[model samples]
Target: MGPSRLHLAQGALAALALGAAVLLQGQAPAASASSDNLTADRVENLRLGGDGVAQRRHMWTIFADMVSDEEPDFVHWQGESGVFGAEAAKRPSGIQGFQRPKSIGGDPHLIGAPIIAYNLFNPAAFAHIRAQGLYRKATLDRLQLTGGTGSVPPFPAAAIVIKTAWWPVAPEGLTAMPVWDPELNPPDPTGNPYLGWARVVAVDPTNISQGKTAAVQFVGRSFPGARRVQLEAFHHVAVDAAMAKQLAGDPESNRTAIIALGRPIAVNDQLALVGINVMTHEQQDWVWGAFWWHDRPEVGPFAADRPSTLPGPWRNYLMQAAFDAKTPRASDAGAHICFNPWLEARFPDGGQGGGTVSNCLSCHQRASYPAAPFLPVTRGAPNLREDPALAPDRLRTSFLWSLTLHAQRD
Candidate 1:
């Protein structure tokens, strides 16, 4: 959940600013505003059709003094976490604009601690869909079905936490690299929903059971001792060197996963927070309107020798991906649902009890951050994976091509 706490969003969040789409909107009806109201127009006057948007200091501000010193933790984080809810979560006036937009992770300008990059490396096509059989009956219906529930394991946890992360200060005096421009200030350009390139400090999980060492909890209370019982197995290619050039010459998105925890957890870690699962590709039924999606705009910047381009039938273009993509809806029962390591989340007996794994575990389990899956990712950085010219460990292996996606269905 790049913006953090997806399931949240429950009540008064009407109190805005993750830079309310660039400092409280208002302006631009083609352009020019003393106050037509896009949120009072500041983010550098904005301009969509003319092409000048990403304002708020041309985006990637890095940290406008943490939006003027955390302005009361962004005003009690806009009235307690859920970033505004109740009234059935408003925003339907004419599409997009209720409040709470900014926050690409640590709000107000940025200054480290944002974390939302990807590639938790669990390849071999998620170990061949965890040795399927209809994915072992959808992991027994995500460890056992929902709401009125039957199938269980909804997040037990014997250990698998990376907690809070945020580190970005040296792009070597940036000239062109960081970006998260949501747009609205006089700049609608189709109201750029999200286009942040990518940015996560670490975490390369995929040890299914090989276990190389993992015991690194760093909860809240603002990180005190920040305990550290064990170590190793996160490697993340030694903490992201942009994955040695996106895993070079792919080995089916290059293999070697690390860490595998399953045995229930969390009871007194008592910090109503949750995270680190990573797999929410759901908008299905083969293009079910594919949510009218947009911006593929004929892909982009391809050629870098196009990652050598040849491998077993183009290696399914290294297993394609598109989770929710703005509004993409696809159907037939499935289209965008990813997070395949045989879709793990196996916790039936460690801390909380009733195991966990519905993928989205039914509406994000009433989210207080409960296994949060805000997962909107891929807003922009269009290397579009699959083979975005190669890198996310090299692509391919969305479970070794689901039979090349069922051989494109007979």
Candidate 2:
């Protein structure tokens, strides 16, 4: 959408300034200081040798900024009320400080535990869409019909889109942390032993009412121990007594769990972030990265080059990044997979076998307005040849699925 409308003039001007700022940094050398310092050239020049050691460091800076930025949390940002519901729509301007998500919604596709996912937009991205009125179906439809050439309307270079996964915590879960070492449980060979187990809630799809707790899985890692000084290890949020009142809207439900909000834990309950997918529009194709929390964050190729300043539980994460769909071609022989287990691991069409082989940029490349099926190919290189989604001149969403999934009808 162009700035042809009088109403969007002011926003368009602001976007220009933001665009210049982003382009300036994007064209420059990778910043030595720790911020969102990923340059487009750095992403384009990435190599997969040594398991992408240098590439992982570049991606970690984005993660560091996302978790440690003094800005309001993604859930509290603008337009979340309409997209994720009121629980996520706490206005940022009025907020006193950085607040965590009020409630986390469950994803049925994910097999075990009460898993939650979030689609977040930074200020620059949200402001651009709001200015263009792209959130409305009518506007999107109009643009689809009349909007000029190009695959998609390019977003500001500073624009960021994030998808994060979280797991709710219970008091019993905290106390039940397993200390078993990997040497003892050789059969359970997916992840580390110190990472701890997550309480799995099994649900029958046909009968939502019928459900029960399943066997524990190697998914979560809990907070601190007996020592008073030991703070929580994960980037977590707690629904305290006051916030609980605001959410429930009932005096009696204040101290009780907000089960209706998809949070089974009580009023003061907490949830820890488990996985995240981050993307930036600084480049034309966009820079993509995925992260999953790990107890032994020190090990693995994904954990390479982590900055010392990454801060707190954020350091306890492993990362993988993909700059191009098929640059450093499949040396690992896993189809150049770059996916978060919590966010995409369960989808049957996620990859050739499943999420294990999925690539973020490849899947997101199919994001079009009329809504194309996001099918992931077995291999990372060579995207769908004759994409039915891109045919018939569909309005591309510039690799943002949120625009297709959550755009409102007015």
Candidate 3:
């Protein structure tokens, strides 16, 4: 059957650094979110990634299904895996046992590099996938580019490619047909199984570039505890340096990227959003809250001044992920935690649209910018002169007060 009922907001808590201007927020010192909560330490420890041998066996044995250990309605997890792991489903291990493509690039079936994979319960095929698993692995409707891929360098943090899919299962290619079998589907999204919101995460055996077979973490979500629901989304996803500039207002706005999608959302009631690192650099991006969003799913008119929807603990976690200055530009690198107010949503979207506002520019420019997609140089890079101590993170010292909008003319 569909499983139990749950409600997850379509805008699954999204956050990215705004170049170096101040990602999570343009905060003040005291605004630093309490590291105590927000699963900070849990992320710091490397073991959370799980032992490779054991993990592989588990996925194969279970054949990947949407597994969930009930927490209070406030925190119904779809089942936990490594840092960037997804629920167990056919996504990770389809007909072929886990195998990576010879040529290193991206995946045509999923998002990210297929690092960590778990389960995605599709709805329409209730009779097919109901007995177990999150949702059936299938595609939803709409969109231009159906599939794409890229190479994921071995790094400590997990990387994920996200997209909002639809219609759980159809004839094969993208179609417009869905089925909701209440007797077997009420617990899930009727005929919805595994059609939307997933990550093609890259998992390394040794956490090194030359590691072994890269694994996948296919994850999906439904309102953790509440029934089913959907939200609209308007996102402008960008990365690295360009993202930083958008927040700093460096290019005065030209450096920004934008997009809009509308869809229904489900909220788990307890946890806001849960996934793994989509991209990693010298900086370790911790999940931060207290980001600003004008609304859900559908992003509103963005301007110079806007508040963040991200919460506090979530913000600090992202702010803490760091990078070593000496690391090579192209080689594996981690960034110190950074959250861009420029990216609106604070949670993950379950393959729909219209949840929060976002701008992912630097990611598009992955060709030129090195290190982190789009981060600000410590003020004075090639020519522009500025100071490092005055960095928004350094200045605010906290994630909360940092979110405040300021005027240069002052």
Candidate 4:
């Protein structure tokens, strides 16, 4: 598929921003979830009327509530071990546990390092798998080839999937850096890290269907083939600034570093809301949402007219949808959250480049199972449409590649 007209439209917007002499500066004031732009009333109205912005705002509200302990709660903490509190599946243990490689860095089988995921299906939608024992490889293979409603059954509205990472914890205000040891399939128990936060991607069928028309008009993109809309949210548990500083200074090394800097101070606090990524069928790319906490003085504010910058402390907490792929520039993009610049910096060619320009949708658009042989280490975007290996016939694992683990043999 050639670049859609939407791409061209985004380019035009970028041109306009570049040509302007007096660019907007400072940051837009933060808006409360109940504000006019993101009011609960507006969300309900948009849900009923089928507005894309409403869908984005509504999802943002839900995520905000999760982090802020707000009203109309839709998410809750389920703890570190196991899936939703159930003992983690032991059969698919070892390298076959979850297929997707670590989102940040390290080997696919390593623990402590961040891991990619697509397995989180809401109870209603996941019931299909449970009822039919689809978690089994044999059953999952059959379902992938000839099951579900559409090419992929729309995750029941509100169904959520997550990508999570753990931070090293220590008592004497010091801890060894977590390393990837392939030989240690599940990693030594003591070497394992604790949960830092989870990045949530959820399906909202109603909003997706409604957003189709609105996206084309507002964002210059359209997803006519979309059966369900998806939104992304982030949850973070703060760490000590001293630990963060140590980790930030030498994320690659520094397995053992101490007494080099300041006192230990808390960084992230509790399981708080970070940001949200909203999508419209019109723009295959999604919109990013972030909180003031991620904002920086140099980067202006989160989602401000000016391009945002990633400084100390907030460097690791990167948000997707930070820039509009159409414009492909930080100044033109909206305020969004994504992976920390440090993490993206580790993999320059990887989807998360260490720059003002990044798009969660664009990066994830390449998500696939039985990924091309050159995947994992291959930086840059994969040619899904042109590459025969990625052809739909060869098993396009929808957007969640981790789900492939269900059918993967140990």
Candidate with best lDDT: 2
lDDT of 2 at 85: 35
Sorted on TM-score, highest at the top, how do the candidates line up?
A: 2, 4, 1, 3
- Model 1: residue 56 alpha-carbon error in angstroms: 24
lDDT value, residue 279 of candidate 3? 22
Residue-level lDDT of model 1, residues 62-151, one tens digit each, is 122112331311212111012112232132211011123212122211111122222221222122233332123233333323323321
Measured over all alpha carbons after superposition, the RMSD of each candidate to the real structure, in angstroms, is 23.1, 12.4, 24.7, 18.3
| TM-score between model 1 and native | 0.19
Candidate number achieving the greatest TM-score relative to the actual structure: 2
> Candidate 2, after superposition: displacement of residue 353 in Å?
2.5
Candidate 2 lDDT by residue in tens digits, 63-159: 6556655532565545344333323334442111122333222223323222345456777777677777666667678888888863456777677
lDDT by residue (tens digit), candidate 4, 134-189:
33445445655776432333333323334333322222321212222122323222
**What's the lDDT of the predicted structure labeled candidate 3?**
0.20
Model 4 Cα displacement at 184 (Å)? 36
- Candidate 3 differs from the real structure by a C-alpha RMSD in angstroms, to one decimal, of 24.7
Cα misplacement distance, residue 238 of candidate 3 (Å):
29
Q: Candidate 2 versus the native: TM-score?
A: 0.66
How many clashes (backbone N, Cα, C below 3 Å) per candidate?
64, 0, 179, 17
The reply for model 3, stretches above 4 Å from the true place, is 1-410
Better candidate number, 2 or 3, judged by TM-score: 2
